[model samples]
Target: MTEATHDDRHPMTGNRTDAGVDTGIERHEYDVVVIGAGGAGLRAAIAAHDAGARVAIVCKSLLGKAHTVMAEGGIAAAMGNLYADDNWRVHFRDTMRGGKMLNNWRMAQLHAQEAPERVLELEEWGALFDRTADGLISQRDFGGHRYARLAHVGDRTGLEMIRTLQQRAVDLDIDVFMEFTVTELFRDPSTGSGGTGGRISGAFGYWRETGRFVVFESPTVVLATGGIGKSYQVTSNSWEYTGDGHALAMRAGASLINMEFVQFHPTGMVWPPSVKGLLVTESVRGDGGVLKNAEGERFMFDYIPEFFKKETADTIEEAEGWYTDKKNHRRPPELLPRDEVARAINSEIKAGRGSPHGGVYLDIASRRSPDFIRRRLPSMYHQFKELADVDITQEPMEVGPTCHYVMGGVEVDADTEQSIVEGLYAAGEVAGGMHGSNRLGGNSLSDLLVFGRRAGHNAAYHSMRTKQRPTVSAEQVKAASAAALHPFEVEGGENPYTIQTDLQDVMQRLVGIIRTEAELRDSLAEIERLKERAKRLSVEGHRQYNPGWHLALDLANMLVVSECIAKAALERQESRGGHTRDDYPTPDDGWGALNLVLTLPSDSDSVDLKHQPLPVMPDDLKTLFEES
Candidate 1:
C-alpha cells in the first residue's frame, strides 16, 4: 500500500452532475427531533418531555427492535447494597481501568455516580429487574467489573429496559416517528448574522414508509444514535448501528474524540459462515464457561498481564477459588476483561490450538449441568439451535471476537452532554470520552441511561432559554432533498450490497482486533477506493422503504467514519487500550493523559487530527471520589 497525504476536501460536497444526478432542491421542520429510538433516544425524549419541550423520536426501525433490544447482558450501576464493596468509586475505577485510563475522567465519574439513580428510575417506571430475597435489584458479574454491579432481568435486560422507557414515553404523549432516517442537519442561515452562531437549528430526513422528506425545526437536537460496528464485516451490531450520529456530528463540525478505539467482544459464534459472527454474550462466560483450545487446554493463564494479573487467577484450583471467594481472590479466569480474553483467543488461534473453525471453544457443558444450563442460557441454546443447528447444552460452542462497540465518538461535556457545537448534544454510543479505549461489558447500558437523560434535560433547558434563529430557506431544503434523492436517480453502475460487503471486508482485515502500521496504511488506501465506488453507487427501486437505497446512503456515512478511525489510529503513536499498534508497542506517559480530537476538514472528506488537553479534576470533583 502506498502512503498518501491527508486531503482536506469535503468529499460529500462534490458536484453531483458527474454522477448524472441533480443536486439542487427544498427544507422541512420539528420542535425536537431525535434520530435514534434505542435506549438513549427513548430516555432523551422522556427527559425532554419532562422538561416541557415537544419531542419526536424518529427511528430506522420499529419501536422495540432497535439494537437496544438485542443487548442481552445487563446495565452496570452502583446500587451499593448488592455487594458491600461495590460503590460508585469502585465502579469509576473499574471503568477507567477497563478503558485503559484514556476515558474522560468527568464522564466516567458522572456516569458511575448517576447510573444508580437512572436504574432506580427505570424500576419506578415499571422495569422489573431480577430481585434478591430482600426485594432489592439483583446484581450479576460481567467482564471488567471488579464487583457484581450489573442490575439485570435475566438475559433480556435491554428489552425490558427499552420497553419500560417506551411505555413511559407513550404515557407522556411524545410523538413517535418510526421508520424515519435523518439525512442532514439544517442550520439557520440567519444564525451567522445576529443569532447564536454555529448552532443547529433543526434536522431533515426521509420517511421510509411515506417516501417523503420530513424536516424538523428545533433549537435543540439530541443524537443518541449508536455505534459503527456495522462497518466491520463480522459484527454483533444491528443494521441500525451505522454511526449515523457520529457522521452527522462530524459533518456539522463537532469534534470527535477517540474514534480509533473500537471494542471487540471475545465470544461471537464462529461456525457456518452465515452465522459465524453473531454475538455469544458474555453471560455465557459469566455462568462458568471456560475458554479452551481444540486440545482442551485452557489458555488464558499464560496471557494475563500485570494490569490484570492480580485480579485474574492462573491455575484451575485458583480459578475455582476465585469464583467461590471473589472478594479475597481474583475474579474467575473466565471473567477477565474483554480485551484480555480476546487477545488470549487470538494467541490460541495463532499457536495452532484453535478449533476446526478458526476460533476457540467456549464450553459450559462440562462445568454446569444441562438442566441448569438450559435454565440460565436459554437464548444461547435457542440461538445456536435455530441459526447454526447446534445446542449449547449438548455441545461446546465455537466462538471468536467480533467487532462489538466503538469506544470513540462525538466529544461532549461530561456534565451537560453538549457537544462543542452550541445547540447539539450527543449520548449513548455516538457520544465519546466515556469508555475511553475499551468499554466494560455492562457499562454501555448504564451510560446510555445516565447520559441520555442528561443530554435531554440540558438540550431542553437550552431550547427553553434560547429562541429559534430562523426557518431553513427553500434553497437549503431543496438542496438537502436533492442530495437525499441523488442515489436513487443514478443509473445502475454499482450495487450497494457489493460495495458494503467490500467495505466491511477491508475494515475487518485491516482494522480488526490486532493492528500494525502496514495494515493501517492498507486500510486507508482501501477506504479511499471504497469512497470512490460509493460515489458511483446506485440502487434499485424508489426512495420508499428500500433497504438497498438506504444502505447506499449509509455506506457513505460508514466510509467517512471508517476513514476517521483509520486516520486517528495512524496519528496516535502508542499502544494504549484498544489501539495497539505493533510498531508503537507501548504507551507514552505524556500522550496517555491527552484526548485525540478528529476535526472535520472545512472543504473535504479528510479529518484533521490534534491532541486536546484533557480536563483536570477540580478539588470538589476529586472530593466525590474520596467520599465514595
Candidate 2:
C-alpha cells in the first residue's frame, strides 16, 4: 500500500545482534560459488557438488525465500500426459513463436529438449505434481503452449519447485551462506587460470546480519540472481529482484543482449492500491476465465494480433469451446503470449472501458464451477479472498498489467551458459536470449531447470580443471569493502531512497510497456541524473540490519540496469513483443535480425550499445518452423 521504504522487514537482513565494532573480515574458499538461492541457484549448487567440486550457495535471504518461491503458474515441459501427440518439437515451436522468433535458436532447442527430463528428475526427487488418470505427471495449459504442458502443484508450482531443489541441495551436503549479499565479483587475471585472459577469481560481499565483509576465492562463479522488476513501481517481483546478477555480469566485463524487453503480465490485481500489482496467475485464464471491459464485452477478441490470428479463436463461442474440446477449437485470444494480453489490457483501460478499480475484468465465476475453481486455483482464491476480500469463485476480479519478467539479461554461450567474461556463468532469469523479446508463461521455470544444471556442470568442470585456483588479494577485498561502505562515510548527501524512487518513476513513466524515442532518451537523461545522485547518496544507520545501506548498494545496480533498458529500447526502433514502441509501431525485419548489445568499458562507468547480428539457425531446426 505504501511506497517501498527502508523500514519494511527486509528478507536480506535477518534478525541482527550487535557484533560491536568488529570490522574484521571473514574469508572462505570454494571451487565454485553460486550467488542466489532460487531454483536456478539450488539446482546449480547441487549439480556442481555432484560434479566433484566444493560448491557454496550464497543468498541475500533465508533459504526457500527467494523470488522463485513467489512464482505461480507452473513448470512447462512436454511430457504429453494430457495429449499423446505433444512432444519437444511442438514445445520448441511454441516457444520460438511465443518469443516472436528473436530467441537464441540453440538455447530454445536445448530448453525444449531437456525440460521434460528436468521435470521428471524433480518428480523423482519428491516433487509431487498433479497426476493424470494414468498416474503420469499432469500437465496444465498456460499461455503460448500448444498443449497441456506445465507440470504443476495446483497454482503453487514455484513453491514446490524451490522446496524440492532446496531439499536436494541439503541432502547433497552443499554449503550455504544464508543472509549474505554479494556486492562485487572479483576476477584475477594474474592467477594463470586455464581460460582466455582472466577467469573468475572469487566474489566479495558482506554478511547482512553482521555487516562484516567476506570473500570467497573460487575459479568459477554462477550468477543466478533473478530479474529487474524492482526497477518498476508496480511489479509482481519481490524486493530482492533489483538487477543484481545482470549488473554484476556487466560490471565484470560481460555483454548483455536484448535489454529492451520487459514483460508485463496481463493479470495483476488492480484494486486496493497496496496490492495493485500483485500477480493474478495465468492459470486462471488458461482454465477458461474471460477478460471483459466495463461494458461487459469480451475485449480480447478485438485486440488479437495479426501474428496470432491464424491460431486464435475469433468468436466467444469458439474460444469457450476450447476449454472442453481443445482438439477441435482454436485457443482464445486471452491465451496469447503475455505481451499481447498485457497490451490489450492497457488498451481497454486507456479507452475508458476499465473496471471501477481502473483495470479490465477477469471473470471465472460465470464459467467454471465453484468446486473446480477451488481445486485448480486454490492459491488464486485464497490470495484474492485474503488480500482483496473478493471471493474469485463468485464474482469477477479487477485485473490489469504489471511488470513481471525481463527477457533480456547477461548474454551467455548457449551451450555452456558462460558469459563473455570467462569463468562467470549465468542461467535462469539473469541470462538473456533464451526468451528473446517476450517470454511465454511457464517457460521461465523450465528455462531455470534446463540451463541451471548446464551452468553448474560446466562451471564445476572449469573450476576443477583450472591448473591453479585464482585467489582474491587483500588489496582487492579492501577496495571492494571501501566502495560498499562509502555511503556511510559520506555526510549531507542525497538520500538513497529518493534516488531509487526517482529512478523507478522515470522507468515506469518513460521506458515502460509502451515507449518512444523521445521518452527513452529522456529516461536515459534522468538515469544519468540518478546515477550522479546515487554516488553522493548517504546512509545514516550502521550496516547491521540497515535497509538504508542495502538500498544504497542496490541503487547502483538498478541505475546501470535502468540505463541498459532505456538505451537498448532507444536503439531498437521497432515494436516487437515486450519492447513495444509507440512511434515505430511495427516489427522491422532489419531490427529483428540484429540484437542490441550493451558492454561496459573498463575505463568508464558508462555503458556502450552496439547492434550485433543474430546467429544463423541450423537447417534442421529451420525446417521445424516450416512444418504446418
Candidate 3:
C-alpha cells in the first residue's frame, strides 16, 4: 500500500468525501451501546433488547464479519450427546486444568454450567450444527476436554455461529452501525447525574466508509472487542484484533489481569509467506492427526508436560487406540492443551527437525480416509488447496505456532461481567479471568455466549434502574477528537505504518511465546520509544476508506497493549500456561497463587502493575478436581 500525497490538504480537516460517503459529525442515543459486533456483541445486544432497552451495535467491520468466524473447531459444551458421563463438573475440571488452574473459579464455573444452554439456544436460533445418529447435535473432540464436547457445524462452526447471532439480532430489530471504529470511550463529567462521578456516558469514533465522526450518548457500554493478536506479526487474528478493547478499558481506569498470558495456537499455516500465520484449526488433531518432525516421527510424546502425563499416552499404540476407544486408552500427547503443543512445535523447529517451511508436519492423511477428512475438515481441505496448492487429503500440512489469543483483558466481576468503572461492562475475549492462561479450542465460543449474555443483562438492568442518566461532556469529546487527529496534526512526521511494522517486529521477536527478563525489558524500552514515535505519526490521506489512516488510529492502542504485555511478562518470572519464560522455565508456587494486574491511571503516562491473589475455589468445586 502506497502513501497518499499531501496535495494542498489542510491538517485536522476531513470535510471532503468520496462518492457514497457521508461527511460531518453525527450523534445518536441509546440505552446501551455495544462497541463490537462479534458473537459477544451480538449476544449482548440481543439480551439488552430483550430487557426492553434500546440498544445499538457499533463495529469496525460489516455485520457477521467479526473474527468469531475464524474459529474452526466448534462451540464447546458438555451436552452429553456422545458420552452420557459428560457433565458440567467434568467440563469445569477440564477448563481449569487446561488454563493451568489460573482461571477465575466462579467464571469457569458459570461458563461450564451455562455453556450447554447457550449452545442449545443457538440451535434454537437456527445454527445448523452437525447431528448424530439420534439427530442430536454432534460433539467433537478438542485439546484438553475429557469427552467429545464441541457442538460444531463441521469445520465452519464459527461462521455458522456468527451467522445465527447476526440473524437473531436482525430479527430483534436492534440498531446497528456497521463500519464505525470506536476510538475513545467517554464518561460523564465529575458533576453528573445520579451523582456517580465516573459512570459511562457514551463512545466516540469515525466511520470507516465516510470518515465522519459519530457519537452515541448512552448510559451503559459493553466492550466485547476481541483479542490483541494483530500486535504481533504472525497471528491467527484478523486485521481488527489490535487490542482496542483492552487499551480502551485501561485508558478509562479499568484494570487488566494476567496481561502476560498470550496463547500461540499450535497449528497455523507456515508456507508461501502470504498466509503463513493463518489458523489451521485444532480439529485436525482432534479427529486423528499427529504431529511429525523432519524424521517423520511423532514428536509430541517426547514433550508431554508432567501436569498432563497422567491422562496422556506414553506409547504410540495406546495413543492410536484412543481414536477408536477413548474409554480404555489414554488420549494422545497431540491432544494436550494448546500451550504444550505449540511449545513442542517450537522445540522441534528449533532443534532442526522442522519442515522445509520452518514448521512441523500435521499428518491427518495417513490416519483417516479421504472421505472422512473431507466430510469433517472441509474448510481445512479448501484452505490448503487454494492457498498452498497442497492437498490435505493426500499429505501432511506444514504447521507451527501463531499468536492466536490473549487470556488477559479487562478484569471484571465474575457474575455480572461489570468492570470497576460503573456502567462499563466487558465479556467474551475482551474480559479477563475466563480462560486464566491457555484457552482450549472450543471454549471461546461458549465463553462468548455465557458472559456476553451476563454483560448485556446487567448493562441493560443498570441502564434502566438508574435514577438519571449521565450526559457526555463537551470537554471529553474535544479531547478525544484531538487525540484521534494527532497523526494528521503533525507536519513531516514518521509514517504510522512504519511504527506498526516496528512494533510488530519488537513484539514478535521479544515478547512472543518464549519470553525472558532481558527481552521483556528491552521490549518495554522499545515500546516507550514507539509511543513517542507514534505521537509524531502522520497520515497523508483522508480517512474515507484509507487503510493507512485507519491503521494510524489503531497504532496508539497497540502501543499501550504491547507495553502491558512486556511489563507483565517482566514481572512474572515463572512459566505457566501462555506466558512461558525461558529463564525461569517452570511454574513457581508463589507466582501461581498470585496474578499480575495492570492499570492505566488517567493522570499517569505509564501503567501501574500490582500483585493480586487468584480467587480460591470453593470446597464443593475443589472436590471435582480431587476426583480421579
Number of backbone collisions per candidate: 16, 1, 0
lDDT against true structure, model 1: 0.80
- Estimate, for each residue in 287-401, the C-alpha lDDT of model 2 and write its tens digit: 8899999999988778766665555433346444342223454566688789999999998898999999889999999999999999999999999999999999999999999
Q: What is the C-alpha RMSD of each candidate to the true structure, in Å?
A: 7.2, 4.5, 4.3
Candidate 1's residue-wise lDDT over 441-462, tens digit each? Answer: 8898999899889989998888
Runs off by more than 4 Å, candidate 3: 1-24, 191-197, 312-329
TM-score of each: 0.91, 0.95, 0.94
**Residue 487 error, candidate 1, Å:** 2.0
TM-score of 1: 0.91
> 602 in model 2: Cα distance from truth in Å?
1.6
After TM-score superposition, the amount by which residue 544's alpha carbon in candidate 3 deviates from its true location, in angstroms, is 2.4
| Each prediction's whole-model lDDT (CA) | 0.80, 0.87, 0.88
Where does candidate 2 stray beyond 4 Å? 1-23, 191-197, 312-329
lDDT at position 128, candidate 1 = 91
